[model samples]
Target: MRKRVTMCQWLSDKIDDEPEFLDNMWFSDEAHFLLSGHVNSKNNIFWGSTPPDHCLQRPLHSVKCTAWVAISTHGIIGPFWFEDDDERSLTVNTERYIQVLRKFWVALGRRRGIDRALQWFQQDGATPHTSDRSLEWLQQRFEDRLISRRCHPEWSPHSPDLNPPDFYLWGYLKDRVYEHNPQTIPDLKAAITAAIRAIPREECRRVIENFARRIQ
Candidate 1:
């Protein structure tokens, strides 16, 4: 609790000191979207003379897809699917996370002609994100601007409420994605991608504005 408070203050001050910090910072995180988890009772509606018996069967080991994204005031960086070398779906580990970052993040920067020095990267203290090699790779690019477990001011562990992706993006996407009631993994993935692309730039700016207020 103390650490969380301290870092919040530190970040709040940093935001005050650097006017462009929020816009340049890329806050990243991952989430698992399950097919079975899409079941919402409120969405089930039937109009008939008699009440109909409805049963929604969900698999025991539900098929799911994990997606990673980075958002900032500039806009969202990705809705990248976490897949293996063979193009099979998989959970995130140190190796896979590093691979995705190198492939997608690096490629995006190069393609857009973005200078590494102008942007800062933020990640939470998840084991895969904080491992020695991971920190080293982030340090090589972001230098002192990297925000994570061992970085300068460090990030609070139990502070998802502080991350834009956590506080806003995931919930925002899930609400619309599941609204379509995707029954298959492919359908879920399509819905997610569509929802991501639908987020307007104005909303992103407002999200960062809210973030600034919270940290302060």
Candidate 2:
């Protein structure tokens, strides 16, 4: 809690010092979408004294996919699907991450009118994200407009509360996506995309604008 508070303070101070910080920033993260929707254990409360009749059996293995998405105050960017490697399992390597970044950069310009040179990108410290090759690629394009392990204004470890996607956007989308209980991978992907599209521009702006208050 102390670390989180300190980090929040640091963020708040930065935002105050640079009023244009939020406007030019893009927040990015990856999330896994499972065939079986995410069931929040805390929301499974039973009212009966004897206990609920439901028995939730955990799946031994579930079909899932990793998707990378980015958002700015303007709007949401790519919910790009990660390509599976030789093992036929989706894993983000430096090369794959770079590919997503390249595609997402183009999408940002076409969809949101954000130029790579004008935006400050934020990403968490996943292994692929922090790799030397990935860092170099980001540097070449975004120059100093990056927030990562090897960049200025680094994100703190294990601090999901500071990330808009983790704290708000993903949860919001999951709640809507799971409403249909999508049965197949394609259905799940469509549901996820639809949910993202449904998010209002005002909501995006509000979340981005509220960052300073949240940190405080």
Candidate 3:
């Protein structure tokens, strides 16, 4: 709580110095969309006369995909999927993350007619996001526009509430996607894409605009 208060104070000071700070800010994060919708012991519940033994058997391999998404007051950037190299799932590395950023930048440029020099990019302290190679790539492209572990005005670690995508968008997306109850990987992907697209531009702007209030 102390750390959160301190971080909020720091953000408040920054916002006070620059009233337009949130306008240029972009938030990015990655989330896994599971085929089974993240069913866990605590949340999983069944009601029946008899114990459903067959339904209790867990799969040896759970099907899932990781998607990277970014949003700004202008609009959204992507639902970019992290490729699976082997049969097993893979974590995003610096190389893959950079590739995603390249695509995201192109899309962002096309949509907003803005360059990296004019924007502030915020990312969490994930290993791939903070790696030396990743930092170098971001520095070369975004320069001082970065907000990460090693960047100035660094984001508070483990503080997802400070990020709109984490605090609002992801949960909103997950709820909508699960409503479709997709049965396959492609279906899940389609659902996620559709849900993101369906989000109103005004709502997105409202969330981004509320950043100042959140910090206060």
Candidate 4:
């Protein structure tokens, strides 16, 4: 659970050695997922149109899919939903992925002028993130605010328990959004927005602060 305190320690020292994780004082990149099916009966029935012989629309198994997202404790930076497939069609690609990150930076600094550069940023070593192109872009665009980006191998994608938005945030959102079956994409999207807004700041802190304990 405790590999090293590279991220927090560095950010802490820069901002003064004070606690940061739970104080609503940090930022991180996150991904969002939209599941296609629910944990209903093993042999549930879908009441939509189907072949004369087919009884329902339910798949034989659960179809959980994900979207690439970058968010922080303050609020959502942005979200990019991937093309939905049977799930196998999805592969983690860093090249196209960096585009989403680029868009996030634009929103944080250029569009909104929130100056996310002043905030701490953390993310996993997904292929695009570590690629020469992505880093080069970061170096070019963020030349002045280079200090804003926090680098830590330990904070990369391999570790999810440390990031509560995956475990805690989505579940909270899903429970609220999937209150009923979402037959279409728009139905699902509305649910997602509602859920994201509902999660309290304190709840997010609990998950991130106790990340190490949870991992252990």
**Index of the highest-TM-score prediction:** 1
Q: Residue 5: error of model 4 in Å?
A: 5.9
Task: Report the Cα lDDT for candidate 2.
Answer: 0.78
> How much does candidate 4 score in TM-score?
0.61
Ranking by TM-score: 1, 2, 3, 4
lDDT of 4: 0.51
In model 1, residue pairs whose N, Cα or C atoms come closer than 3 Å (at least 3 residues apart or on different chains), thus clashing, are none
Candidate 2 error regions (>4 Å): 1-10, 39-55, 85-89, 111-113
Q: Which scores greater on lDDT, model 1 or model 2?
A: 1
TM for every model, in the order presented, reads 0.86, 0.84, 0.84, 0.61
Instruction: Report clash pairs, candidate 4.
Output: 94-128, 124-156, 124-157
Query: lDDT tens digits, residues 1-216, model 2?
Result: 665565567678878899877888888998877777854432234577786678878676777777789877888886888856532337788888999999987887686455656778889889999999999988888898788865676677776776888877888887888898889787888888888888887888898877657777
- Which residue segments of model 1 deviate by more than 4 Å? 38-58, 85-87, 110-114
**Pairwise lDDT winner, candidates 1 and 3:** 1
- Model 4, 65-166: lDDT tens digits are 444554454556444554434323244566665666667666667534355544445555555565677667665655433322234323533444455555
**Candidate 4: which stretches are off by over 4 Å?**
1-35, 38-65, 84-92, 110-113, 139-158, 200-216
